[model samples]
Target: MPTAELPSATPPSTAVPAVDLRGVAVRYGPAKAPVTALEGVTLTVAEGEFVVLVGPSGCGKTTLLRVVAGFEHPTDGTAEVLGAVPSPGRGTGLVFQQPRLFPWRTVGGNLAFALARQGLARTERPARIMELLTLVGLPGFERRRTWELSGGQQQRVAIARALAGTPRLLLLDEPFAALDAITRERLQEELRTLADVTGTTVVFVTHSAEEAVLLGSRVLVMAAEPGRVAAELPIGLERGPHTEVAALRATPEFARLRGELNLALTSAAAGTGEEGQLPPAS
Candidate 1:
């Protein structure tokens, strides 16, 4: 079977964006002394596009993801996912830094729980569970306890669980941040493949420039203090089954892109009241 193609950088003119935010802003605390998490943030994510938000800590990366997930309402502007206003547990799948799996349930059972919540029939759940497990490279792990798996394996299960609901969009908040270098790289490849195969639009938040460059079709760099978009860079690297990741990373173009992003991020951090702080690698 032919591998699925990545979505084009240019979406069709009439296509409705998977996510649209217009002059969005979020504030916390009382009206007397409020904290601004985001300000004048306007963004649109095309269908099947994998967009990464990268910035230093407290840049409102997580806040932006929460707004899109409908967990938090923006104090200022509009936030929309799949055309209408987004709501929790609707058309969106979320993966956090931790696996957040049910230790009481087996790997398969955890996925089955999500599928069941989606209203799948009991008789059809097993096959779908197996398919999801396989998709995350955890086939036949249905009976295995969540605690028995390695950290990376547990995270794979988490990703599978997120996919169980068949979400149109996936919101990941540094899901691979805690893993070791090798494990993180492997998961990154798997996630890229999974997104291509499912054509799931993804909005991932991370502090790692390498992660952003590798996973995102477009990288949006945000700045601190009332976080806002500072730069947008489209990855023009070739992506296909034949492309070797190591070779791609070794290329001068990859280094150039990474440097460009690092500079943009550094520049955004400058004069933002949090100067001299470097971006996190994980």
Candidate 2:
């Protein structure tokens, strides 16, 4: 679950990078016996970019996400979000593989809790709750108990809660990984649309190449064993308000990108270092 830290005193700035990390590294355990999770990872995410990280297990995808969210600090290098050091509640929203909703709260109540944590006053919460629910395609679900909702619906509520803070950056860690195929696809479409509509910077972590291609404006493939970026691909999908996921996925370009990502992922896992360039989308 995302920590409910108070928003920073300074308002988020659009003038600077949404996320900037320079030669970042993370390690655990004692000084001499530290287990490295990430090494020499430098990444910059501009405002409104949907960046996805995909790699095999033990890669630093989740560690990178944690660093950006201010949940975990990098052992080396500097990380800044919106021109300031990242800290919990500092203009970030987080969602994970599990919905992690408060079972005790009703749908609206959960959102209300988040809104309040983000400094929203009580009087403003009701309207904001309804708006968030509507945005997530769950209009009028304010009264629904979290336990009463299906897995997909529960995740939707979780997303709504995450957005309640109107976060400038949204961090999602395989939020759709646990769902059934159909539900996962639906949520993927919804999430992509939501990101566009909200214009929020996002860093999503997943193991699926298809999901990376489908959602990210930029896809990063990381190599494990002291994880580092092995490949970077820009998803140059031409999209508009009316673009549909089904139509987009059926295109030859989508297939090519997916194939490229898969090959890169394989190479990275094997430490082959063969596929690193971003070829022309044409």
Candidate 3:
């Protein structure tokens, strides 16, 4: 099948992109009967952009994220992050669907662990942990044990831990999928605000079109059989410091955009191998 045509990965400016992938592919098992996980995938995520990958299960969203995180190597083509080849501990942070925290540690301990890896001095860790917690809306909760916190709170601590290393790129794979609707929506808004405040480039994966539309500055819809991008849409919502999620969701423009993304996702799940007929980004 011909690779779907995606929007150009290059940014409007000359600055190097946070992620650059060209003809990237991943396959597994015997050569004769190799199962292709991703094929002819090309993507570029600009610095400070919140890019979301939305697709059904088995569409290689997590696989693509792992490729960028340097946890998995591509079988063909080149992938670069921060203008260089990607590898573990290369100025990137990751959050999985589960809050993979150290069970023995307190929330502060978790952030301290990451800070220590970044070569922070012991004397400075206390202040830094508080600061990081504040950023995630868990101020002064560092002393709480991981098991003592609720699911959303634990994930907030997990996010703080990831931020301790001051990574330029943050990769998240369905981090809020397990939470209740109320908690998930709250975290979604918080995360969007956090991204804006910190200016961190984010590549998030999700199966929900609503979540993608709510949080992403741009969204990419992917197909399943030999997973590849089936569509790309730039979100043009007028978000500001005062913008509320409820108010934003009630707008006609927001509904229209959501409908468009839903249609793209439907086409991708249908396995038609056809690119979405979206208008060119302005």
Best candidate, TM-score-wise? 3
lDDT of 3 by residue, 1-282 (tens): 122246454446577899999999999999999999999888899999999999999989999999999988999999999988898779999998999999899898888899999999999999999899999999979888999999999999888888888899999999999999999989999999999999999999998988899999888988888888778877889999758788889998788788878877777788653574443222
Off by over 4 Å in 1: 1-13, 272-282
TM-score of each: 0.91, 0.92, 0.95
Checking candidate 1 for backbone clashes, the offending pairs are none
Candidate 1, residue 63: CA error in Å? 0.3
Kindly report which residue stretches of model 2 are placed more than 4 angstroms away from their true locations once superposed: 1-15, 274-282
Highest-scoring model, lDDT:
3
Q: Give RMSD (Å) of candidate 2 vs. truth.
A: 6.8
Model 2 quality (TM-score): 0.92
- Taking all chains together, the TM-score of candidate 3 against the true structure is 0.95
Q: For model 1, how does the per-residue alpha-carbon lDDT over 1-282 read when each residue is reduced to its tens digit?
A: 111122222334569999988889899999999999998888789989999999999999999999999999989889889988989879999999999999999988898899999999999999999999999998889999999999999999999988888999999999999999999988988899899999999999999998898888888888888687766777777789546567679988788778877876887777442222323322
lDDT for 222 in candidate 2 is 86
Greater lDDT among 1 and 3 belongs to 3
Model 3 misplacement above 4 A: 1-9, 279-282
Worst 10 residues of 3 by lDDT: 1-10
Worst 10 residues of 2 by lDDT: 1-10
